[model samples]
Target chain A: MPHDSAGHTPIDMPDDPDARIIRALKALLIGRGFFSADDVRRKIEELQSPAPARGAALVAAAWSDPAFRAHLLADGKVAAAERGVPVLEAGLIVVENTPSLHNLITCTLCSCYPRSLLGQPPPWYTSKAYRARSVRDPRGVLAELGWTPPRGIAIRVHDSTADMRYLVLPRRPDGTEGWPEGDLARLVTRDSMIGVAPALSPSAVGRDPSGI
Target chain B: MDRLRFAIGQRVRIRDLPVPGHMRTPRYVRGRTGEVTQYCGSFRNPETLAYGGNGMPTRGLYRVRLRQGDLWSGYRGSGQDTLEIEIYEHWLAEVGKGAPDAP
Candidate 1:
């Protein structure tokens, strides 16, 4: 499990040529004058591990408890801290997804994400197209991500800066009442937290015919 | 640049700085009206004109709120839905407060 500065684990990436290049650079830099590349490499490695499943439990609890949901929305960092999610002091804002409103976040300038909660950002998120089009045409971006908000729903696009990170708290899906936290965690994908996708219900999971 | 300060509900305009490479300031908000909703502290300006300009170490950060109606006049959605964005100090200026007229 890769651990970041905040002690949160990130998802692992498949080893590829790019990964090799990163490793080589780490070795080259550490072998020279730059500060211990090994330390940096270790931190990066920790960031690549799958994030702890603890956050899932909080989401699940919020799904079943309206009070908790309100608390989560009122002060997400505090609520998550109570749940042991290790909310970093990076000036993060938790935007809630409601039936009438949808929120999408992008770092037009750079990739400033809530790594402590959602783990590493997906590849599609770092794409130039996603960044450029997110603010200009958010509805189109959401559509491309397979989310079509109901008519009359407003979509707000937030561009994260270098200092502030943003996270989207997706609305609790239907047919999830009485579901256990362990079962609910499986439904929360990183994309949902970014507002590019919605949380999956049991029926939707593994229901894709293409095996995606 | 020094640390920037502003309060919630204070309207400000984003500056159009000529920065090379990619920057966090979206082009759309370059000269748009936004209000400071949250105060984010200082941090390294990622857009560090790497090619050689100023070697500043840190920049101020703040979260500004832009109403959908303000951003898009034809925006047909709820007026309460506002987009909050984080911006560096160098990217903002007092609204209607023109830059000093060059002598």
Candidate 2:
């Protein structure tokens, strides 16, 4: 392992072959004038800046407004564009969680996540275990992920293909009536939106709800 | 035809054949039959796109809904447990095409 010019370890870089290859590719592209270092950095920052906040904002708005929720379920792209969330480029469908039916999203072939709405997928979502198990045994998979829906509620797993993406609109947690959109949004976590867990209950709010 | 061939509520089965190249259909749902819940518009085939093809020729896609019991034996979930997946047209065949009153 080679040290940096300042002779300090870069925690950003762990000894990974993929990182070394990417660095080499970046250097080659820069040398060939195909892209500047600033361009790469800007792109990296753009991807890194995308978080679950966008999805949470949309969910919060929907929870507070029935019209918005109906619009989101009817047409996700238009609803997302209306909210300035930037999901219109791809086909998106928002599956709502009903009293008797639960919705779970997964991409079995590869990690075809809804990057436009929720940013990158959580690491476990891309793992083979999740991809295979989610389709075959969604309830069991949900149990493993620390969420077990009450019995008798049918679990419907959506296996997303490259053409279309699915987003889960988890039922709003209890005891949040009359809550403002912003506060309701705070309770929406990425895992909840992915259907592996439920939106944080009022008791679980004001603390790190992510079990990870 | 790019337009959807399978009407909503029609029954179809995912082909279980071994494809030689790229494919978007997951193996787990292969050969399983399901009802067409929605008509997803046409799109370029991912199978060809993965191989760097132009992907110009599009195929119809549908949201197929199936019961978990149909896909797995001894399903542990409630009897009403169901699943849905977006599958391309070419991979499906109508199950009861000649039956009377078949939609």
Writing each residue's lDDT as its tens digit, candidate 2 over B5-40 gives 888999888777567667888887887889999877
Per-candidate TM-scores read 0.73, 0.87
Kindly report which residue stretches of model 2 are placed more than 4 angstroms away from their true locations once superposed: A1-24, A206-212, B97-103
lDDT of 1: 0.74
Query: How well does model 2 score by local distance difference test?
Result: 0.84
Tens-place lDDT digits, model 1, residues A48-104: 663735456667777767798788777777788887776674755678888888888
Q: After superposition, which runs of candidate 1 have C-alpha atoms over 4 Å from their true positions?
A: A1-25, A32-41, A52-55, A65-71, A205-212, B1-5, B18-24, B41-60, B67-82, B100-103
Error of 1 at A152 (Å): 1.1
Give residue B31's lDDT in candidate 2 (0 to 100): 78
The per-residue C-alpha lDDT of model 2 at residue A202 equals: 74
What lDDT does candidate 1 reach at residue B33? 82
lDDT of each: 0.74, 0.84
lDDT of 2 by residue, A12-100 (tens): 76658988898899899999999899999998787767789899999999999999999999988889889998874469889999899
Error of model 1, residue A79, in angstroms: 3.4
Residue-level lDDT for A98 in candidate 2: 83
